[model samples]
Target: MKDGDETRQREDTPFYDHPTGGWGSLKSVARWMVKGRPSPGVLDTLRIQNKPGGHMCTSCAWAKPPNPHLAEFCENGAKATIWDLTRDRCTPDFFARHSVTELQGWSDHDLERVGRLTHPMRYDAASDHYLPCNWDEAFAGIGARLRQLDPRSVVFYASGRASLETSYLYQLFARALGHNNLPDSSNMCHETTSVALKSTIGSPVGTCVLSDFEHCEMILFFGQNTGSNSPRFLHPLQQAVRRGCKIVTFNPVRERGLIEFTSPQEPGPMLTGGSTRISDTYLQVRPGGDIAAIAGLCKHLFALDDAGGGVIDRDFIAEHTDGFASFEANIRETGWDGIEAASGLIRADLEAVAEIYARSPRSIGIYGMGLTQHVHGSQSVQMLVNLLLMRGNIGRPGTGISPVRGHSNVQGQRTVGISEKPELVPLDRLAELFGFEPPRDEGRTTVDAVQGLLDGSVRGFVSLGGNFARAIPDQGRSDGAWAGLALNVQIATKLNRSHVLVGDGTWLLPCLVRAEEDRQASGSQTVTMEDSLSHIHGSVGRRAPASGHLLSETAIVAGLAKATLAPNPRLAWDDWVGDYALIRDLIEATYPEEFKDFNARMFTPGGFYRGNPARERQWKTTSGKAGFTTPTVLSALGAEPGDAVFTLMTLRSNDQFNTTIYGFRDRLRGLEGDRMVVLMNPGEMARAGLHEGQRVTLVSAVEDGKTRALPGMRVTGYDLPDGCVAAYYPEANPLVPLGWHDVESKTPAYKGAPVRIVA
Candidate 1:
């Protein structure tokens, strides 16, 4: 903690070079909705957000367009709907004038700008503040500390802002208290695109849609940053670059919303600032070089299908795939100088992006969390599903493989039953539709729930909404294991630093947000989510509940499952919290082949499409087809970077989203106030003797003798990719290392992490 002691302030600026949803995204949505003044019925609930019975635009999941756009949301979904309909608040005399050790020295954008979160407080470790408490005494002291633990040591988690009837009643109140653990927020970003697309296309989601960006023809991107993490996917890449398609991208920061944008709803390119260019080839690659740039674009599309050049779809790979002769003999025995020194490009630019994916007849591929964080992030998402199944591109239409997800129903909280593995959910149909027996062991992933709260084997934490101590990853070893918890709950709507990191029985509990109005007793309710193309919509809110003492994440997971289970009768839990269509008829009796008719295809319009058994090409894996894996590490940082190291990665700045820090500007890399800067590469900041704005520090190349580092950090430079760097994410999440990650989806490799800088 040295050189100008970090808690913000590093102004730098210059480098935005414009064009991303023009008029600077309508003046950053009119200065973040007049700095979140919200609540004049929150501008009439932003005119029913993604429309059709209105509501689902609690930000990034990017799908909702089925002929929509009378303002079909964007600009960080209007700063996450004016940071969730703000009107300030915080209450209980603002946590009795701040104390949890002085709001732990504030600044996570001033700890969620101290707003919303109205009552249900608790945590007074004798005057450390947070008083209010009631909803049945914080659910009888979090159900008497989860009835003396051991329900697999109690964790729960669930933050894709709840809803599929409060994540099936918070994973059926943690598998009827017998524990299926259920960690969430997609186990920290796309759990390696769900463990490498369910082992190469047996389906773990994303087989295109949103009219496959108007019948593709080409699109590629990787290590995604779709104009600040899916800004409503820049109006389908500006109508697929005005109908000619062709994009391409790869990344190590050539991102300015994929190089050009414009549509603040297109009024003649917002009065002729006329833009729409978007990556007609970008390629920087490097930090964990996406498995050597997806195995050098599947070895130059297998040398253009062995020069016969019909660019392989060899009759849809001889009848819909499976290994392809040891994946074309491991891409013709690899080496093109180890794919140009682990893909920092050049082989005639990967054979000119494999001749624009062999003269595009349809493409698509998109990606994010820079090809899923790293340590070979599930073999770079199974080598981008073996370059979209070498052209048989997973079941037709403008091609497949998307990923671009950032919360907003984090893939519908892993498709309605959060998960901590147990064979990717369905525990014998939720133990015969709720009579019990659901545990099935394996549970705990948010890096094994912060190594089970620093190894006392997790004593109890609940969560429902996120900000889990500023989105996990060794923040001073998870805030010194959050006060050695014996129980800590959250169920939030604001007041974040994981609700004042308290313990020995905390509580918080402020719910109701997807833009308000929840009501119950058989009336006004309507939830459901799921995007990132597995579709299935319906949202509902329409203003008015920022506080009436909140509550409705299905009535606080059915009043904490009627204050911790024991009533059963097939789990009525107060008639599924007074009717959420009886929790979508027990989530269509625990997934009847994916909620068949769950409430008559939920509000239709742009809402239903839940099918994707490998996009109807069927092959739900175990060799029923679509396979081709062959990876053995092409470059998940197994080498290079010997000079003052680097490879950093973290990201998320266009005014943040995931760990929700909505300001400290980052108007597409031109920075602003600050979030501890970094971004390097002006010749690696003069080979790390650093300069431009230098405050330096970083550290963590982890041998674990402790000392993670991340001091002042300023740096700056830019046009990245030479041994790379870049920062912003829970402020470089304390230089990472919570046992690093992604050795097959433990996830944390927050884009690569190896750090070094120093000075």
Candidate 2:
């Protein structure tokens, strides 16, 4: 840690190029709802609990409104229901007064503000601390350590704060306790938009929904950042920029809600002093140059359809689609000097962004995890569905191809299964509706559960609500492969850093969050979810239950499937853990074509859309239609650049969400009091001898042998692009290096890696 030993003085981080949700986004949602201390009647019932017929948004799967707009939520869904309905708790005299080496010296926003994990603890190891079990001794010590391990040595994981009847009863108690391993948080963000839109739109979801953001005429976004990771997706991009639509961002950092917002709940742009304009063209684009800025907008839409200018679609590409002549000979062999030196941009700004998608005929595109956390993140979402199927933008009216998703039912916990490859549904309809026989193998995903817990074939490890060792990535080798696991549980409600990095027998159960109130025996229940424009609604939790020893994530997956299936009786687990509409009638007997009448359309008024047969253009693939891929990595995004290497990408901080930090300040990229700063680009900080706030160390440029570095960090500068830089992720996740990532959806590359700063 050189650059002047400890470094400080350059604290002027605040940048703010105007616009984003005014009153500085309602004073940063009243300073994260007065530091999650809620009251004013639980902040007036988190303002109609998620909305419409109430209770749904547990935050970011976006797509709401069967009718909303009276503060339907956004200020990070009122700072994620004031961080799980505040009223603070974390009892057992606060884990017998801290220790796990004293809550590992606090901070993950002070160990979730020392609150809410009211009961079920464990991990005693003779007072390493956390000792208050019961819930029948933490489900009979996690069912006698899942009957002394080896149901593929247990793994589980599932977060996106569960529910879809607790991720279908935690994948039906991990395939009825015989293992499927599950893995989750959509195996690190949109498992590359569900593996490149189900290999080019056969469908893997998101073929447009939320009223296609009110009849889109053009939107774009790519490698998204609208108001620091989904701020109520800036009110349908501020009502499609007040309906004159025409967004178009790109990334490499311009963000502030895509440069111009102000919808502090939009009442005529928050009572005049207006501010709508959202990116009518932004660009920046460089860290892993999103496949040379989307193959220079498909080489300017194939040179405006071979100069005839009829802008392709030639009768919906000869009825539907499939390899358009090798994707128009790989976009007429991508030229423009490797798309203007890997899309720093020029060539008339990719022909003025392909003439705003060739004079828009209802477009759309959006993206996230900055093009799926790069390494050619699933070939930059197959060049965003090859620029939304070059116009016939997947099934009509206002076009498709979104991704967004931060959580709030991570695309409905993979639509009720929470996969790690459960062979895309149907194992004889999950063994004829949950009786047994399901695990058809292949599981362990968040990077094969850290190489199945460093190869002892994953000895236990549970999770079900994130903070999995600080949202994974070689964190000092996932904190020593989760302290050489052999049982770690976590279900969680507050305390984090994966519950003091558990391991040698850990438990910490404590559930019921999504804003509390979840009962059983045919009383107060209403779970279901599946947003990111797929809908499937129903949420219901109006306060009360930050404690009473918590519970309900479907009664802790029916008390760990009745303590690991003892006397199983083909599972009843006390009448579906005392009724949750009998787990939505066994998720409509294992997904009977999109939950056929799942509880009479979840009390209507805004919760039932789940359709997407490629939004009715019905290309359900295998050559049945729509495919045209071939962006063959736009000349591997013009490879070169390594004069002391740079390309970093790791972000997620506007007062964090996603590994929930809620503080350590991001004030929308004007940072503060460090979260290991960075940003960069004052002409590559004077060609790399860096300066502003200089204290660096980054390192890693491929020596896969793992020893990555990261050190003190801090850089600053800004308006990126030249050899890029950034920083944030699970604290630059040890310079990243968990198999770099994304060779068809192994995701990771947290947005292009190859670091080097060092000073």
Candidate 3:
């Protein structure tokens, strides 16, 4: 059938009408609770007791000995806790029973059902099996391979879980080995935000702390849902709401967190089902349209400034910023019709949002991936910075631009120089400190790393932690790229899809989890993490290692460095790894100004705060001031009328984090027992002639000629925008072409793709 005609036929089919709270959902939760040996209540108790410091609070990382006298668990935190504390364990015997070929067909949920890894294993290609390997051998093999490579070809990828000391040493080893290919997970996610913020305001990280959320009179949360993503920040949001702060949201999807959030921290009210209303004004903007929304607000503010309304902070602009005249001119030339069309919001709606923002004495703008994972993602963030600068809404209590980071120490990883492009001064300083000239050439990013693998440039792949294959877009190409590698090394706590998709040589080096104690050679080591708020705090693991075989990431890095650099040592690698203090000493020597007395500072209970230029309204741009960046006119990629195309957006399920599936249910969205279903607006469904619960095929209309026909996918009607459909990632990743990515950031445009529905 023709794609258009098939859509019509599918539309006519009856929807699978199921109750929101069915027995199936209950059974799923019950099964999740009691699937393993430990009872559900016992597991919950263990998680609570395991909370930072014997605190019942499950949300905050700062929960101390004396637990708060209230319900302290947020919904998302509960999910994370439950998933981490799962009783299931995949022992070595489990791998012995299942062959690689047999395991390949298993669903993501089914693969994870065997639970966490119990031992380190090396894949034997000849036997087509994974056998347990000694930590020393694993390190020796990895080190030997790394040493053999040109070092420039060996990419050391770090996830957010790596502590500051580990990240610092990782970067050091790469530099010492003559390569800077630190293609971290941050590159794929917040690299745009970092680039934009650094270019506009010097510092790449967020300017606001968690406590600052409480001081704001108004908060404009664009393209972010805090409750589901960063549940830890929900308490401050709840507090802000209780104190009568106006909260506004701009997103395509009406996320549950932005609608109503019950602070598991509040006692009687939480138990009685009392929840906090998050957004006072929710503006559903079209995908990739955030720049237009911010531009509209800027134009409105400029008009107000011209009318002598004092809406724009003239003093701050003149003193601390540049390019206002050009910015103003650009905004004047940007017609309201174009802004409205691009943003998919009327002038009145834009005006309403501007009115709230303009009226508030102190306001903050918080955003997430929705704003940064687009073609002009960096420019979108710049526009937000421009808006904030116009109103002088930064560097004050309760007012700043906050990008809610996904992982715990994502910001921290970047702070300690886990970057592909290391600055010359840092490298020079490293050389001065370590007695070796660091690599000068810029290295590969995540995209570059993938390309390296594809072109046979990358000889070895070493991941500190993360499921890279599944997390990256264009799964087929990514899998192929991974398969072409000469060696694959993963330091992880659990068995993931990436481990299975190995090259000729593969080694899964089991490592200590964040919840476990790391008794390093330097005694019990405490690692530091920079939270979303730029607060650098110490995270010391209190529990024993999950297994005795697991090694600390620091020790692992040290071991690899010692073994690899034995033949050609420009510097001493063994001495540094013997004590984490030496690593800190090098960090101090390299970044003296920022990390002065790193050892002493880490001993402090709360750690320390990093420098934020925005706090003082100081712009460290080339012109010594913040500069307004006017984005070029964005050309829409919407499908033509005859193309029979619909926009397909990929999303993370409520029970998943990136590619890791905790369960097959999205509780807040009311989706149960499935991740393959497509969520479309009822109007759009009718317009496309598609009915609910229709088993249809989704083919990409792009030139790549790739089609993913997800069969038996119930077409559930939802509140998405017109011409747009939403599906879970990895499952829907096949539809996204390998080359389809944001040009500036190389981030996969998972939210915007042209597709045609068929049956």
Candidate 4:
């Protein structure tokens, strides 16, 4: 296919884009090719086929069974299904056929072609082989190396997919082993949101629940794409629209999911060619300019309040919050000209949004990584809280702020206390429950962990679920730093780029996926997940084990703890992991108020609701109320004007998860079969004297002077704003320097890194 034709095919061409539904017919043909013939009695394998009453599918442990009557599978859920059910296996002989060095040259997809890893393997550098090793030997080797390092020198990272029991035990083991370096995926994604929310509302979670959307009169979605990113969210959004909720969107790219969505679950709507119109009004704000937009809206709202309009909730403001006087002063000082210039929005557009918010009886603001991946992410989040507070949105039905989390259990992980700096209260509880005081010193965060590896302060690394090296920024430096470690351990399901970037002593330990059942002494176990709305639900795996050698993350951590810290007199580690219930008991003992009746609540239909002081409009600040945080002089990008460098923004594809690629296709932007291309506006392309399909190197303009000249990078033209270009992460991460992170949040400014695009 021609490049243009290929781009067209990939770009926003939905399954319903074609007259006969583009992928519908092709999917049928592909199914026949694989299954020989379709039987009328044969159920659609891709659809949710199981009955509604079973425990979470033994295959991909989702919390609830699909309603046999409804659209049984979500888009990303389908991707996860195909990934798990693929009739391919990676056996010991496959490793024997190709040495580790040879396999290292293969792409992430090709490595998966060797199929699922069926046995435990250890990388031997001298022989260039990943030979099969027994579980005992693997555990012993990992334990001995971990014992060799000072506990502080070893970093334990967890991913959101890990069970609550596993996460609780992992943190317990790290504390028992004398370290607090529990840097997980949360640090990289929504740590800023948590920090901002906790400081402002006295809660680290969203105050609003999914039912709030139904009650909402107006919904303002900032920087989040619901359809492409979170398909399940489309249901609530569609329902809200049907209820006459006014939906306003602020995103750089006009996502199809935001404009119109045909329910994949509702066959009648799909057959009738009817779709839900999500956004009542769409505003494309410039990248890294969310704060300015929010500030402008607040300025407009304050103006209305001053004109005897009384849009502000004087009672709520007086009783529930502080620092309003100083906050109002900052908004007054910020001028319309500055806001317009920075946000790329006009005064009228700002007024229109403000008017909708002011007139509406109830409103909610939702945002995603787009607003939090910049240098002023925390400030931007605070601004959103400020906007909500202006109108008494909190502690009300259908009104509040929501940071749509990406992973299923990202919120749950943090709730269970997977943090680098566990608060003093939690630490006290840990000490009392576990009979040992956790190290009082704050340990490494995600960025700190990377720096520790670089400075040689960290010698060993253990990742529970995520691909840390690949998911982090500055992949070039991260690769080297990770490889330099004395021991690196990855517990994962599928093969990814991180697996190839091994340390001196590397171990790839396969573990049970969320879809698979985890059995222990406590009988069958079900893990809990916290959704974006702060609703905790149970996730029970139903699929059989993929390999007998594979261990549940809970068991793996327990085995490692036993092998490494058994000799220490800190605490009883083996007793905790012998049964996950003990771990849950400890967790409940530590956070009694939150996890009270923990086991009893798991059987509840929808699980439980985590307490949010903000929902009660009770601020948990030092002064016993919500407080507006006055941000210092804000600089969206630290780059100087007239500097010939373009800012790079890292993004995900429709066919991918955070760092896991289901395929190389980006169907939204019309990019096919390749992820190395950079998207730029036509005007910017012309300004740079570049043509379509031109390959260019991206050089970081940060102080470190890091350079990554990826050759054959197709320069595709898009509708992006001038002076900005977009590229896929992990590939484009080299363009971001380690030192160039958000000052307050310390989040890598992945969405805004100064770079010079060149041919």
Best by TM-score: 4
Tens digits of per-residue lDDT for model 3, 565-643: 7444545556655666777777777777778777776644334666687677777668888777777753223332234
Candidate 4 yields a Cα-based lDDT of 0.73
Candidate 2, residue 659: the lDDT equals 75
TM-score of 4: 0.92
Estimate TM-scores for all models: 0.35, 0.35, 0.90, 0.92
Q: Give per-residue CA lDDT, model 4, range 1-759, as digits (tens).
A: 123532553462222232221234236335433532222222244443223322322222222322233544455555555565554666678777887667668876666545566787788777777778988998999998988889899999987767677888788889888888988877777777877888788887778876687799999888886665776567778889998999999877667677777665566876787777778888877777788888889999989989999999989899888999999999999989888877877889889889999999799988887777777788888888999998999899989988888776777777787888867238887776657777988878889988887899999999887778777777667666766788988887766677777756899888876556677766777666555676555556666667777888888888888888756454556665556667777778877877888777764554466677779877787889888877664435656323677778788876677777667766654457778988877778888899888888877777654565556678888766667888887678777777777666677888888877768
What range of 10 consecutive residues in model 1 has the weakest lDDT sum?
1-10
Write candidate 1's Cα lDDT for 1-759 as tens digits. Answer: 111311121222246767887898888889877887877776667767887778887777788876788888878887888888878878888778778989978876777877888889888888888789779889887887788878888888877867687887888788888887788877877888887888887778788888878898888888888788777787778778888898888887766788778877768868867887778778777877777777777788887777788787878877888787887798789888888888777888788887888888688788888777777788878877887788887788888888878777878877877888888788888887776788788888888888888887888888888887677887767777777888888888777778777866888888888878888888888998878887778888867887787888888888887888888788888887887887898888788777888898887888888788787788888878888888887887533576677778888888888787877888777778867888875676786677888797888877769988888988877767688687888878888888787888878888777878778
Q: Evaluate model 1: give its TM-score.
A: 0.35
Q: Indicate whether candidate 2 or candidate 3 has the larger lDDT.
A: 2
lDDT of each: 0.80, 0.76, 0.71, 0.73
lDDT winner between candidates 1 and 4: 1
The clash count of every prediction, one per candidate, is 1, 4, 5, 8
Worst 10 residues of 4 by lDDT: 57-66
Task: Give me candidate 3's TM-score against the actual structure.
Answer: 0.90
Ordered list by lDDT, greatest first: 1, 2, 4, 3
Residue-pair clashes, model 4? 8
Q: Residue 707 of candidate 4: its Cα lDDT?
A: 64
